[model samples]
Target: MGLIVLRPTRATCVSLACFVVTILCLVSNGPCRAQLSSTFYDKKCSTALGTIQTAVRTAVSSERRMAASLMRVHFHDCFVQGCDASVLLDDTSSSPGEKSAFQNLGSLRGFEVIDSVKSKVEDVCPGVVSCADLLAVVARDASVAVGGPTWTVKLGRRDSMSASQSLAESNLPRATDDLDDLISLFRSKGLNSKEMVALSGSHTIGQAQCITFRPRIYNETNIDDGFASTRRRRCSFTDGDSNLAPLDLVTPNSFDSNYFKNLIQKKGLLTTDQALFNGGSTDDFVTEYSEDRSAFYRDFALAMIKMGDIDPLTGSSGQAQLSSTFYDKTCPRALSTIRADVRRAISREHRMAASLMRLHFHDCFVQGCDASVLLDDTSSSPGEKSAFQNLGSLRGFEVIDSVKSRVQEVCPGVVSCADILAVAARDASVAVGGPTWTVKLGRRDSTSASQSLAESNLPGATDDLNDLISLFRSKGLNSKEMVALSGSHTIGQAQCVTFRQRIYNETNIDAGFARTRKRRCPFNNGDSNLAALDLVTPNSFDNNYFKNLIQKKGLLTTDQVLFNGGSTDGFVTEYSKDRSAFYRDFALAMIKMGDIDPLTGSSGQIRRNCRVAN
Candidate 1:
């Protein structure tokens, strides 16, 4: 006996059990060197395709009807603003986005599914995978999940920074369109009549709302009488406008030539669906597709490939300069060598993990992770190493030097000191059992250091909540990101001088915790004595720092201020309860911080020694 698996349907598929067949009909013939490639992210983010596939399959398996909605999202996104993910943006005060456009408001679904896939991809390769490429891949995976023909997805598409509601309203095809209208719309997008007929076969799976097909059932003479009556049972003149019915009456969840078959029998649900066979120029193509499913699949694949080629951004266009695989070919062992060194260093001294992580944070806060913090003081100008905030507190220079020396041995002058710092910070986090995020490479070392920027930008241990928030804000971070990044204190320590006044003078602190801390950090003496930032688990990276904040056990004034009934207090409480949430947000925040103004693309030279310029 065969096992049966029950798959849930999306609430949007209620009663309708059908899917919409919107066409991505753009095309460019002759194939004169495609801008996008199937192997675009092969080295940059190897797991990106697999991650998208898993997320799409999981979503479709949970809600069998979501396959069509996911595919429709890609069509809608591509038609408006050239498949740059403009449809995915929510409306803001400055610009009304495509989500609220007439065709997409309530008709479109499966946005949450795309959001879930993006989050999963971001986890493995943060700042590496573009949302535009994710939509394209998700569309393909959704088709395969429902026993549909698969196609190669050309990647390296970058997401748009803005969306357009007017463009969506003008560009998207309407269900009320007739044969000429549909053909003209496809023609405007560069698709011919035959490609239009093939692409419309996507109606084989998905549901359509009553509002879309009501006029066809009530007034259209080309539609079948029995089909109209069946549709009219649920769709009235004005009521049940949101109710749904399948586009393909026979197999709504499977992809095949059933839509073409329905068109031939005059049972097409939408006016546009019936227009194909109402003695129009596209009638012969529709008849051909209905008879041969293999022919339908072949043309559909070709049409989709053409649609995906519409105005895609590739190479250096509309993308950030940094990439995760910057050294994949030049220095294949760069990341591995750095990771191994970080692990050995952490194993020898666990505190080294926190030091390395903090080193990256401090470097980015000042001059944007350009390795300026590693520079020794020169005769001409002092470096960030001599800044007041980093003077005697900063550590891990030797660890960075050791890693740089080892990397130089294998691929001399190929890996930059700045890129090594970013990778090492991620490796250190994993070594200490914290979250790991991908680090975008291609950052070059700064020729000079700015002690003044380091002193002003880096947050102080004695800073108040407002001061901390403002400092982070200047570095392109919000209060929530500030709170998440501060969670890094879960594994580090503060010197006596930094927290002495907080232990002795602060009233919000726990008395017992203060007394224990004061034992090693005496007043006016032992200024260099250290106390664990997270007293419970000082050597492990977790959410205990937020827990300590809740109990007034935070070692630094800045740490306690995060949970002191301020704007960020809620974040502290939430992290204290959910460690996973804290880790996820922390990893994202780290990637954002790593993007703060950096030297890349011929702006700076790669240094042989991390402590000085080449």
Candidate 2:
């Protein structure tokens, strides 16, 4: 499906505000409903609601059956494990998911529609909206697509990391369940008989497979004779098990009270559907809904609201909703403050730009951009700063301290050291000639640091091709990203100790380049001597690093391996020829690298000092 861009009008905003107020008032009676808010994303991602609505409308317009399919997907998600989005997970070798259960294997549909909406939202705002909340809003938009009632969807639900096929098999209602069985299943999910009857009305708009209704029509006595004859013509005893038939014969594709009306005429397609009105406890409610269409719409909307509120992960339970506008309201001048300080530091020393950027990369690789690298070495804990890779080599600690001090002057305790390091990295890139990207905020600083992990996780300069690829892969980056991110070396400098063996013994290096490097860095002396990583335009961030590799002028063993007739040689050639392609991929890789195992929400705290935890 294609993305539909929508801008909200003034009247639409007013109407949505009024509806949000009404929903808040209605849900205020209970404590469970207070965990979510109707306006949770009003400031975080303003275009999220409109984007989801447009995407759902486009999908349903392409195929009218997708409306009911979307609604059913939401229902199935909420029923199993309390709307945590466990149903959307695909079954892996280690984790068997809900989608492969006997109840949902071939019955579930509209997964691609949800996936499309997620991609569109991530384009506008990444790491902000959860899949669980997306399902809730998609169900509302799908209802309005096909003459169904709409309700305000309370947000702030988080996605589950695990899925349970056993829970799906036991918790979901079956096609052949009687009235007592249906009531008990709904009751297990905290829904009453009235709400169960209201939710059952969703079958009016979707078609059912013949396997689900064959026994109900052929052997059941409660079904209408004419309806049974019509159904039996398509579904035989042994064949045509997957043949399709509508649940409501009157209006199959409209979300009306026709499903309830069909029950009164003994035309409910599934055995569990006809059991509602076959001299059961739900017969009176079914009769009332068939007579009053407005009543069915009202109860259905209310039931949907209740179902969406089932056991959601709210507050500090799940991952924090990171947004680009996270500090807009709290500290309006946060980005500018960081940008100004970073530029001043770069002006004093051009190499400081590369230093600050390297600090971010090292901090993220070790402990997920938590500023653990900035922590001073204490007697009790060695911290990452004293690790073998960063003992006396890493610089720009005072620059980060200066930036954090200035940020604290504007908004104390609201800004995180982790977020400050991330923004500083972006600003340092832009200070020189580098591509800029939006930095997702809301990461918290780690209270503790690990010396052992830092020693193990950080990549070494002498690493071979396979070792380099494996190190980057451990942090969720591919070989292409590894090559693109290595472009940061286009502006930095490597010490003599890091690359001495490459120039002295390696045959891949150019003879002239090795002779020039040996003049500054001898074979065994001047281990602390510095040499530019890129021989041409060492201060600018460009694709010259890749170009140098093509000429066999790479300064480090890891650098030369990227173009040493390996799997990454094509990427090196492509980047050497195209500067814009390198910049774009580098920026995307930076953003992806910043998201590695972040300490978000309440998992970590905002440090008062960059050197010490609060």
By TM-score, who's the top model here?
A: 2
* Cα-based lDDT at residue 407, candidate 1: 98
Which residue segments of model 2 deviate by more than 4 Å? 1-88, 91-159, 162-316
Distance from true position, residue 61, model 2, in Å?
52
lDDT of residue 343 for candidate 1: 98
The whole-model lDDT of each prediction reads 0.79, 0.80
Superposed by TM-score, candidate 1 places the C-alpha of residue 9 at a distance from the truth, in angstroms, of 51
- Candidate 1 error regions (>4 Å): 1-320
- Expressed as tens digits, the lDDT of each residue in 1-614 for candidate 2 is 00001111111110122111101101111112326888998998889999999999999999988998999888988876466666787787876778888888888889889888988887887767777788899999999999999999999776555566755775677777677667755654557889999999998898888888888888899888999999888899889988888777788878899999899999999988888899989999999999999999999999999999775544432234467898999999999999999999999999999999999998988746678888888899898988888988899999989998999999999888889888988999998999999998977777777676677668777777766665565465778999999999999798999999999999998999999999989987999999999989899999999999999999999899999999999999999999999999999998888875555555567888999877
**Which residue pairs in model 1 clash with each other?**
16-244, 18-206, 18-207, 19-206, 19-207
- State the lDDT of candidate 1 residue by residue for 1-614, as single tens digits: 00001111111211113212111111121111125789988998899899999999999999988999989998888766465666776777877878878889898999889888878887888767766788889988998999998999887665555565755776677776666556655654557789988888888999999999898899888888999999999999889999999998899999988898898899999888888898979999999999999998899888888888764433331123578989999999999999999999999999998999999998887646678788898998888998888888899999999999999999998898888889999999999999999898877777778676576567766777766654565455668988999999999777899999999999999999999999999988998898889888999998999989999998898888998888898999999999999999999998888875455555456889988877
Q: Give the TM-score of candidate 1.
A: 0.50
